[model samples]
Every structure is written in structure tokens, then in C-alpha cells.
Target: MYTTVELVRGSSKLADEKAMSAADVEMYIKKAQARIDARLKKRYRVPLAEPVPDIIESIATDFAAGFAIEKYYSQRPGKEEPYLAEVLIKRAEADLAEVLEEHLLDGLPGVEFLPPPGPAPAVLARPAMQSTTPVRSEMTAALERW
Candidate 1:
């Protein structure tokens, strides 16, 4: 049995590391939901009061985590950095999905599953030379005119 701390810690680590892909993130979400469902199924054994909040909360947490990871990686030096950031984002996404699944499995009404968000685009992919080229050319032209 996976402890909540294990799940949260793993998820956070993955997000911070950005080591996951878009598809992997989606799969993580699904797996989390399944885990939550199985747990609730065993625990409640009856319908829930309302599942929508749980679902929404779960999704929100994942999105928030994704955003945070993306923001962090945006400031990093290169695209070649290990994909730890991606992993962290996926973990967040999974957490959200799991919460939703738990509520739904509890028999709460009006619960809906949300799709996992896409991975953050590669910011470090920008050519390092692109920005420098224009400035270099401008300086050269200026020097020629001088």
C-alpha cells in the first residue's frame, strides 16, 4: 500500500526534476485516479455526499504544481538539463486526478474527470546564438559607418 506521504513526496520530486513527458504525465494522472478509486471503494463501500469539490481540488493542485515547475524551469540555463521539472509537473497532475477519482468512487454526484495538461514547451530550445547575432551585426554595421 502506498502511503500518502510517499505519493506526495514522489510527485513533488518528479515536478521539481521535470523528468516526465506529456504522455507520461497523462498516464500518471490515470494511475493516481485508479489508486484513489480503489482506496475509496474499499473504505466507503457506499455513496459519497459530493465528489465535485474533490475532483476540482485534485485537478487544481496538479495544474498549480505544473505551473510552478514550468516557472522554475523557465529560469534554468538550458534545455539539456535533466527532465526533473517534467517529472514534478506530472506528479502534480497525478495528485489532482487521484483526488477526483477518490470523490467519484465514493459515489459523490456531479464529479467529472479532467484531462491531463500538456507538458511545458521547451524554453531552452531557443538557439543561444540567435539573440547575439542581431546585436553583433548591428555593431558591425555601426563600425563600418564609423
Candidate 2:
């Protein structure tokens, strides 16, 4: 899994909320991991191996915490304006999308390897041009005539 239940609890108010059980939190965490994996599988190996990237863990924790909070809301609805859980989920999703879309995981473990950036292309100087005619002398003669 990208993140642990403890991590999910720590990142959000899951530990403070009494509505969700440890098992329920774990379930939500697992689902969040699966969702993260499904989206990242295109560029990284699902269930990412040990030493998972910090960003991945962060993303997973946000997703899990958001899910658990949503579950809590379902069980005990509240009038709290601006649901924080939805914000968490949206932020996590956007972060993950950016990682994939920008190829940000190129060198990270469990991700498809990418070649290092090459040096900047060489700049070629244009050849200097020279006039075949003796324009200086011609101009001098013209000025004299004028």
C-alpha cells in the first residue's frame, strides 16, 4: 500500500473523529491505495514497492483521510460549510494528475525509467559575409563627383 492507516489518521482528523472504526479507516485506506494505484499504474507499478516516494504516500494519505471523513459525514451528517474531505480528495487527485501528466516520476523507484536530460543543443554561428565589390572606393569616387 502507498500509505498506512496510521498515516491517514495522522494526516487528518480521522483519529479525533469517533464515528469511524479502526477497521473502517483501514478499509478506506485500502480503497484509497487502490485508486492511487489505478491512476498511477500507467507510469508506475501498482502497490509501489518499498521506499515508496514521499509524494505518493502523501497523496495516498490524503485520499484515505478524505474517504474516511466522507464516510463519517454519511454516518453523522453535519452543517459544516466547505467539506474539508472533498478538498483533500481534490488536492490529492490534482497532485497525482500532475505527477503523471508532467512525467514527474521518471527517475523514481517503481516507475518506468527515463533517460536523463541531454545537454542543450549546440549553437552554430553564421558565417561572416564579405562583399566582392570595392564599395569603399566606389563610394569615395561618388562623393567626389557629388
- Model 1, stretches more than 4 Å misplaced? 1-52, 78-84, 92-106, 109-146
Q: Candidate 1 — what's its lDDT?
A: 0.46
For every model shown, what is its TM-score relative to the native structure? 0.27, 0.68
Evaluate model 1: give its TM-score. 0.27
Poorest stretch of ten by lDDT in candidate 1 = 1-10
Q: TM-score for model 2?
A: 0.68
Quote the lDDT for 81 in model 2: 17
Model 2 regions lying over 4 Å from their true place: 16-18, 112-146
lDDT of 1 by residue, 72-107 (tens): 457777763236546645664566456545544443
Give the least accurate 10-residue stretch of model 2, judged by summed lDDT: 73-82
Q: Residue 99: error of model 2 in Å?
A: 0.6
Best by lDDT: 2
| Model 2 alpha-carbon miss at residue 139, Å | 91
